[model samples]
Target: MASSLLKTYKKFKWLPFGNWLFSKAICKRAPYFATIKPKVTHLSSGRICAEMPNRRAVHNHIGTVHAIAQCNLAELCAGVVTDATVPNHTHRWIPKGMTVQYLKKADSDLKAQAQIPLPREWKDKEDLIVPVEVFNSDGVKVFHADITMYITEKS
Candidate 1:
C-alpha cells in the first residue's frame, strides 16, 4: 500500500504543469506555439499529451472544438514532443501539415496524445508524421490527426 501510494505520489509530485513550466522557462523560442498556452497533461518516454476544454466561443456555430483548434492541439502536442525529444544544437522541428478526421463533435474536454515511431532516431533530416488521438470527456475518440513535421539537421 505504501509503495503504491508513494508511486502515485511521485508521479504527481512532478506534475505535468511542472514539466510544462520547465519547458516554457527553458524553451522560449518555440515557433507558432510560443504565444499559445496549452496545458500539458502527460509526457512519458517520447510521448507528449495535452487536454483543453472547449468554451462557448472557442467553437463554431455548430459547437465543437473547431477544426482549427483541433489542428492547434495536434501542433502543440507534436511540437512539445519534438522539443523534448530532439537535441537543440543538432536538430530543428517545424510542423508541415496535418491530415485530420473529425469523427464526432467534441463538446467536452478533449485529450490529445502525440507519439512518434518507436525507437526514434535522427539519422538525417527527414519529414515525419506524428500521430495524435483526441478523445472526448466520455473517452470517445472524437478526432485523429497525422501531422507532418519537417525536421532539419545540422551537419
Candidate 2:
C-alpha cells in the first residue's frame, strides 16, 4: 500500500483528495487523496487558485467530469477564501447560489480559482460572488462558476 501511494504521489503530487491540505484530510489510504481534494497552488487575500484532479468517479457516462464535481470545486474554491476573509472564529459562510457556465469539455486535471477582492464599497451586508475559474489539465478553461456566499451574524 505504501509503495502504491508512493507511486501515485510520484504520479500526481496533488493527491490526498478533496479540500486543501491545510483544511482537512479526506482520503486516508492509497492514492490517499483520490476523493475530493484541493491543493492551494497560489493564494492571496484577494485571490486564491487551487487544483483538483478529475478522477474516474467524477466522470459521467460521457467520460467527462460531472457538472456537480465542478460545482464542488467551485464551492471549495470559495470556501477557502472564507478561511482568510472571515477568520476561524469571527464569521461563518455558506453557499447561497451557483451560477455556472460549462465552457468546454474537461478531459484532464483541473484547477479551480476564486478571487474575492474586497470591493471599496463593500457594505456590512454585502453578498460576495466568488469567481471560480476551472481549467483542464492542458490549462484550457473548461468551466466557470460564480458561487455566492452570504455572510451574516452568527448566533
Candidate 3:
C-alpha cells in the first residue's frame, strides 16, 4: 500500500505545476522550511530531488548560500522522501540527528537529492539513514548530509 503522500503525488504528479504546488503544501505544513523556498523536482519510492534558490534571503554574509539553508534543503528532501516511502498509519518517523559536510561554498542555486534502499520488511523500530547531496547550478556537489531518522511502529 502506498503512503498518503505518495498517493497524493501520484494523483497530481501529472497535473501542470503539480509538483510545485505539492512542495508549497509541504512548506505550509512545516512553515520553517519556507525559509529556504524549496522546490521539490522529483519524488519517488526511494529517491527525491529538490532545489533551493540562491536569493538574498538564503545568502550568507559572504554572498553565498548559507550553510544552514543547505542543511534545511537536505532535511526537507530526507523527511519528505521518507514520509512518502514508508508504510503510513502503521509507522512514524522523526529526525534523530544529522551529520553534514560542506564540501564547497554554495554560491548559486542548489539542488538536493536523497536516496535510500527500501526496507524489505518494516520492523518494530529502526534507525534509518538517508543520504542527501546538494549541488550548485553548475552541478558541483557543495553539500552533503546523512540524516538519521528514528522510526517506530505507531502503537
> lDDT values of the candidates?
0.70, 0.65, 0.90
Which pairs of residues have clashing backbones in candidate 1? none
Report the lDDT tens digits of candidate 1 across residue range 36-138. 3456766654687787766765687887667877777777788766666665567777888889999988888888898866666775568888889989988
> What TM value does model 2 have?
0.71
Candidate 3 C-alpha lDDT tens digits along 1-155: 77888788777778899888888889999999999998888888888999889999989899999989989999999999999877887889999999999999999989899987976577777999999999999999999999999989999
Give each prediction's root-mean-square deviation over alpha carbons. 6.8, 8.6, 1.1
- For each candidate in turn, the TM-score is 0.76, 0.71, 0.96
Displacement of residue 95 (Cα, Å) in model 3 is 0.7
Best by TM-score: 3
lDDT of 1 at 90: 75
Which regions of candidate 3 fall more than 4 Å away from where they truly are?
none
Stretches > 4 Å off in candidate 1: 1-37
Highest lDDT: give the candidate number.
3
lDDT of 2 by residue, 70-115 (tens): 8877776676565445532434566688899999988788987787
Model 1 scores a C-alpha lDDT of 0.70
Candidate 3 clash pair list: none
